[model samples]
Target: MGRRILVVDDEPDILELTRLSLVREGYEVETAATGEEALACLRRSRPDLVVLDLMLPDRPGTDVCRVIRTTPELSDVAVIMLTARGDEVDRIVGFELGADDYVTKPFSPRELGLRVKAILRRGVEEKTESEHLKQHGLELDLSRHRCLHRDEEIALTAKEFLLLAALMRRPGRVLTRERLLEEVWGEGIAVTLRTVDTHMKRLREKLGPAGDLIDTVRGVGYRFRE
Candidate 1:
């Protein structure tokens, strides 16, 4: 089967439009009209990705995203938030809640499809790289897509896992925000540089004291401690 996608939106037009667009791109598409329905669908079966709207009738989309990130079985599912609100704060909050990407309302379905393709492609590419990275009490099993701290499992969203892997793979190398964006989110994705800062902040917080290993090089960018 093609990559499965669940598109959650209250608007019938928007929901069908998104489903049709993704289907045209060869994804098996499902639709949900409320946060409750979306969560129900999620619990029933896992999709490869979710196109979640920031606003929902029963609950906020962030709540659904929070559930996905906290649920071990769903944490790795890639999510692209759809929002009428273009505020950076909303985007940052979505990222903090573990969304992989966001598309502002009035978005082009083609661009959304591209974002989906880029994210899924990145995942497939990473899985092909079987190397494991261990350092500073953190271990990344690239093949298994797992992160561990001192042999204890550390839950991370897909972006967080990939972002840390990028830094850990090149310890001590100062990776500028632009470069990190390319490596993590891929080229031509419409996320801002602040998105990097937000994800890094969340990554560090999740790492606890080990977060210190990711050193911010002031304005230049960030590097993993050597």
Candidate 2:
């Protein structure tokens, strides 16, 4: 079967539009109208990605996102948040809550489809690369999508793992925020430079002392110490 996607949105029109768009992209699409239904679908089906709306009739979508992130069985699932609010702060909030991407309302179904494709493509690319990357006691098992610091596992969101992988793959090279954005978020996704910073901060915290290995070059970008 093709990659599974669970789309949660209360708007009947949007829900169907998103499903149709992704289906056209060759994805297996599932739809849910509320947060609780979304959660139930999550447990029942465990789709590879979820297109979630920030506002839900039953509970805030952020709350559902938190559940997915905290639950061990479902934490690694990718999330893209949908919202009517287009403010940067709202976008940042979604990112902070572990969303892989954010789409504002009145969005084109095609654009949303592209965003979903990029996120899912990222996972496929990771599997095709070198399986293990180790630097300064920080290690990434690319095949497994696992990060380890000195043999201790560090749970990271999907984007966090990809960001770390990008840095480690080019140790000692100063990757501009723009470059990192391209490599991690990929093309066709609308994300700002601050999005990179937010993920980096969270990545560093998860890495603990090993986080220091990622050096920020003032005004330029970031580099992983050789």
Q: Which candidate has the top score in lDDT?
A: 1
lDDT of each: 0.89, 0.88
Find the 10 residues in a row with the least total lDDT in model 1.
86-95
Compose the digit string of candidate 2's lDDT tens values, residues 97-170. Answer: 87778888879988898888888888767656666899888889988888888899999999999998898898
lDDT of 1 by residue, 1-226 (tens): 2298999999999899888989998999999999999988987878888999988999999889999998999887888888776686455445578788888889999999999999888767766778989997899998898999999888899999999999999999999999999999999888999999999999999999899999999989999988
After superposition, which runs of candidate 1 have C-alpha atoms over 4 Å from their true positions? 89-95, 132-226
The C-alpha RMSD in Å for every predicted model, in order, reads: 17.9, 17.7
TM-scores, all candidates, are 0.56, 0.56
Kindly report which residue stretches of model 2 are placed more than 4 angstroms away from their true locations once superposed: 88-95, 127-130, 133-226
Cα RMSD for candidate 2? 17.7
Candidate 2 positional error at 34, Å: 0.8
